[model samples]
Target: MIFIDYLENVELISCGFDHNFSITNKGEIYSWGLNSCGQLGLGDERNRNTPCLVSFPNDDLIDIRIKDIVAGNYHSIFLFENGQLWGFGSNRDGELGLGDKNNRSNLTKIPIENVQKIACSKFHLFSLAHDGSSYYAWGSTKYGNWLSSRKLDGQPASFSAASAMILESPITFGLTSKIKVFQFQEPISTKSIIRLFNNPDNYDVKFVIGDRRILACKCYLKSVSDYYCLMFSGAWKEKVEVEIRDYSYETYYAYLRMLHYGCIGINQNRITQLIDLATCYIDKRLMKHCKTFIRDDLDEQTMPTYLPLVIKYEIKELYDKLSHITIEQVLPKVTDSILQNNENSIEFLDWFYNQRRPFIPK
Candidate 1:
């Protein structure tokens, strides 16, 4: 993922997934083992064995060739060609300028003016420009200070471009004549997070439920909504077809109204059509709720309500399994009360509790 350009003039002298090392076209060097304190000047703390190349192009902020890299606990800095300054990787204390003590993994060009030099300490940095101006600084540390131009004595370490000299990493421009360490870093979000267990698909699987006999028959129910308005009632029992006198329209609008507004308005004779649609899914959740509604009132006219329609359609194994539990539990005090007893209910509950779990065992 780390791509290098004009690298033909480069060589892979070293690597430090957690360290540093660098080499040049002529096999020059710029390195130390893991720079836990940016002491290696590789712009970051990390150790490396073999040497690595650290040169970047001179014009681009990033592609500029690097003289060396260094790391501080919370900052890193880079020295560039033409006396140009660039830094980042960490600036929790203004180790980098353009004024905020912000850390940047990517190389950032510092906005300090003139021919220059910079240096870094554990959490402080110093810079010196062509004018020989100096700066003092702190924070992301808790200390707050500044440099020359006494009139600007109490400015934000990065407030004035002229008074900004702090860098996260200390860049040795050419020895003792280095910049002062007053630059501080800006804030960044490093919130701790538990990134795992964020997705359900990572554990998606099937789940099964309920009696099989009635459930199986429920699947065979044909939806009248599937019918068209041909108005020819053919003998479904045989292969005979019937013709119509006039093209009659099926009141499909009733079905549409039911779909769009959740209101089933089909007339009495047409009730079956919409009822089939409403209960077509044969959902266990729906059936669970239906248990109460089925016991509300008993009237022969409410055939669609109290009929054993679904029960008769259930799977034999599940029906038989459920049947073992008498009517006292399935429908105590109701028409099927005598069919299931309380003891059977207790046994069924026990069986349910003993079934294998449907989810991955936690």
Candidate 2:
């Protein structure tokens, strides 16, 4: 029998069936067990009975810091602090999200970022973004569609054709699906990158926004967005230069930061502007953040300003939160004339009565 006596002074962070993974205090990943599909990341598909050090590729090996490990039946996923995701092992069903069904024997970095958690079940993989607003998956078609249905909670969602499917739902009420488009960012030093924006060392695309420029890798865009994927991946494509006119530099940069950092800081001052941009870009996470900020910061004085926004955006959670506060704090102080004059106030009153009125006693 093989013994893993060398695993001393190390903490077992997580484990999976027929495989074991651990992280040292210094944040190094070690794997053991089934390697039929190179799930051990050992550069080969041979199973090992003892723990072995999983090697990462040298080209992208700079500042290699792993934050989490997720293992499926015959595959493994690694998440890095710099919003990078690496996968190894079976891709028979495209569980690695590599846009194909080719099994990887070596550590292959996939084009995705800001992934908070990756749930690997029997044959399904689900990824949740750090912003708590988006979920992604690429696995069995049945599983992906099944989870999408669960996310919709009986609501309908539109299906689109992409390596990884994104189920678009209605954009109103609490039923709106919160989703995001992720991108890739390397941890390489600035000196290594050829340009700040235009065709940066390894980047494939550039977007010009007035005086400012944003550099990006096209892999994720092709997998996530329908427009760009169709444009660049076409057989007739020759050049790639995109002019972004829908969003200002500040808003555009903010969205980029969300892709790189997993979360972006936003203040109440820029909430409305960011919300508009998020809506235009179909960035539901940022939209949700804006609504959450407006809802959490609401009070008696700011009620008029934010309530209309809540109603307009159909943010049922925030609407209910503000409604509860209004019932307890604002309603008693309101005069009959104000309710009679304001349409929103009247609607609120009607809903409030319906909620507060008790049914027949049992």
For model 1, the superposed segments whose C-alpha errors exceed 4 Å read: 1-49, 55-74, 122-362
Scored by Cα lDDT, where does model 2 land? 0.58
RMSD of each: 31.4, 21.4
Off by over 4 Å in 2: 1-4, 59-61, 123-131, 143-362
- How does candidate 1 score on lDDT? 0.35
State the TM-score for model 2: 0.40
* Per-prediction TM-score to the true structure, in the order listed: 0.28, 0.40
Please give, for residues 1-362, the per-residue lDDT of candidate 2 as tens digits.
Answer: 02323553243344555776766545566788888888788888888877787776777556767755777668778877666788888777676777777888888987666654445543333322231223455655533422221231222121112212432432221111112222123322232222332345666666779977787766655554454477677841555556788777776776664554344445444566677777665766667667766754565545676777777767777767777777866666565546567886777789889999989898
- The number of clashing residue pairs in model 1 is 69
- The local distance difference test score of each candidate is 0.35, 0.58
TM-score of 1: 0.28
- Cα error, residue 17 of model 1, in Å, equals 17
